[model samples]
Every structure is written in C-alpha cells, then in structure tokens.
Target: MKHYLLAVQIDETVPEPEDELREQLARTAKVSDEIKAAGAWVFAGGLLPSHASTVVRPGNGTTTMTDGPFAETKEQLGGFWVIQCEDLDEALAWADRCALACARPIEVRPFDDVV
Candidate 1:
C-alpha cells in the first residue's frame, strides 16, 4: 500500500456557525472512525491558523526569523491526514469524505516510494 497525504484547505478568517461547527466535528469523527476501521488511517489532525506560524531561514551561517507563514494567500492548509491506501482512487475517496466533512477543499498527493 502507498501512503497519501490528504490536505484540508480552509479560509482562516471565516468563522463557522456554532451549530455547523458541531456538525462538522461530528462528521469528521465519523469519517475518522471509518478510516480506522478500513485500516487506512495513519494520522490525522487539525491545525492552528497560519498567523501562528514562524519562519526561520539560514543565510551565510546566520539564521533569520520571521513571523507568520511563508505565504499570504486566501486559502491556507488548515489540517491534514496521512493514510495508507492501495491507489490514488482510494485516496481520492478519502479526500472526498474529508472535503464534505470539513466543507472545504482537500488535496490528495502520494508520497514517493523508495525502497
């Protein structure tokens, strides 16, 4: 089985309704349970807003630090899931569930296989 990364993209500034958020959380829990039951789940989680990021770069043996994420964009990676699947199609199915649960976009990518 190959490992795929399922990334969830969300608008950091948008505040969802309390009821809607609750619904989303419930849906996500259900999806997580499904993934686990399928033995595809490796890891999954949500993340803090991009504003909480810190960037560090090294130049000429010196390290420079910056506040906030590397890029300022309308859509940021809000969370992700690492899952082992048979193929891209299976991964896409999982991504679809994630998108529906979170009401956001999900990007699915496979990790390179090296033995």
Candidate 2:
C-alpha cells in the first residue's frame, strides 16, 4: 500500500455564508466517518487561515522571517487528508468524495514508494 495526500484548496480571503459553511462542515464529517469505517483513513485535518503563516529563510548565517504564505497564489491549501491506499485509483476515489463534501477542489498526490 501507498500513502496519498488528498489536499483541499479554498480561497484564502472570501468569507462563506454561515449556513453554507455549516452544511460543508457536516458533509466533510460524514465523509471522514465513511473513510474511517472503510479502514482507509490515516489522518485528516483543516488548516488555519494563511494570515497565521510565517516563513523563514537562511542567508549568510542569518535567518530572515516573513509573514503570510510562501506564495501569492489565488488558491490556498485549506486542509488535507493523509490516507493509506492500494494505489492512485483508490486514493483518487476518496479525493472525489472529499471534493464533493468540501465544496472545493482537491489535489491528490501519492507519496514516494519507499516501502
């Protein structure tokens, strides 16, 4: 089996309506439960807003710090799930469910097979 990351993306600044956000959260919970029951769930979590981010770069034996995300892309990684699966197809299936539940895009990537 291999581990895959099901990455969820969302806008960093737009505020979602309360009711819609509630529905999305509920749907995500349902999907999480289903994944757990199937024995495919390894771990899952949401992320804080990008404003909470900090960056550090080392130069000339000194470190410089910067606030905010590493890059200025339109979409930010809002959350993710790490799951052990047989192959990419299985991981992708799970990612599909996640995207629907979260009402956002999902990016599926398999970890390097070193096992």
Candidate 3:
C-alpha cells in the first residue's frame, strides 16, 4: 500500500460560527473513525489558524523565520490526514468522504516511494 495525504483546504476569510464548527467537527470525527475501521488510517489532525504557524526559510548561510504561513492566501491548509491506500482511486474515494464531512476542499497527493 502507498501513503497519501488528504489536505483540507479552508478559507480563513469566512468565519465559521461556533455551533456550525462543532457540527463539522463531529462529522469529521465520524469519517476519521470510519477510516480507522477500514484499516486505512495512519494519522489525522486539525490545525490552528494560519496565524499560529511559523515559517522558516533558508537564506545565504542562515535561516529566517516568519510568523505565519508560507503563502499569503485566504485559503490555506487547515488540516490533513495521512492514510495507506491501495492506489490513487482508493485515496480519492476517501478524499470524497473527507471533503463532505468537513465541508471543505480536499487535496489528495501520494507520498514519494523513494526514500
């Protein structure tokens, strides 16, 4: 099996109400449980807002750190799930469910096999 990353894309500009967010989290948790039951779950988690992120960049001989995401976009990676799948098709299937549960876009990408 190959590993895939299902990235949740969220638009930060639009604020989610507390009640709605609670419902969405409940749905997402259900999907995560399903993935675990299917033996496909490797790991999954939600992330703090982009403002809580720190970006580190390499310079000439040192590194510089910034206090936000690498990109300045309203849509950012909100969370992710790493799962083992038979192929791209299977991974996409999971992404479908994940997107529905979270009511957000899901970006599915496979991990490089070569170490």
Which window of 10 residues has the lowest lDDT sum in candidate 2? Answer: 106-115
Candidates arranged by TM-score, highest first: 3, 2, 1
Query: Candidate 2 residues 8-94, lDDT tens each?
Result: 999977889999999999999999999999999999999998888998989999999999999998899999999999888999999
Q: Provide the lDDT at 10 for model 2.
A: 95
TM-score of each: 0.92, 0.93, 0.97
What's model 2's TM-score?
A: 0.93
Best by TM-score: 3
| lDDT for each residue of candidate 1 in 1-115, tens digit (9 for 90 to 100) | 9999999888877887999989988998899999999999999988888988889989999999999988889899889999999999999999999889878899999998975
Error of 2 at 103 (Å): 0.5
Q: Of the candidates shown, which would achieve the greatest lDDT relative to the real structure?
A: 3
lDDT agreement with native, every candidate: 0.92, 0.93, 0.96
Candidates 1 and 2: which is better by lDDT?
2
Residues 1-115 of candidate 3: C-alpha lDDT, one tens digit per residue: 9999999999999999999999999999999999999999999989999999999999999999989989988799999999999999999999999999999999999999999
**Candidate 3, overall lDDT?**
0.96
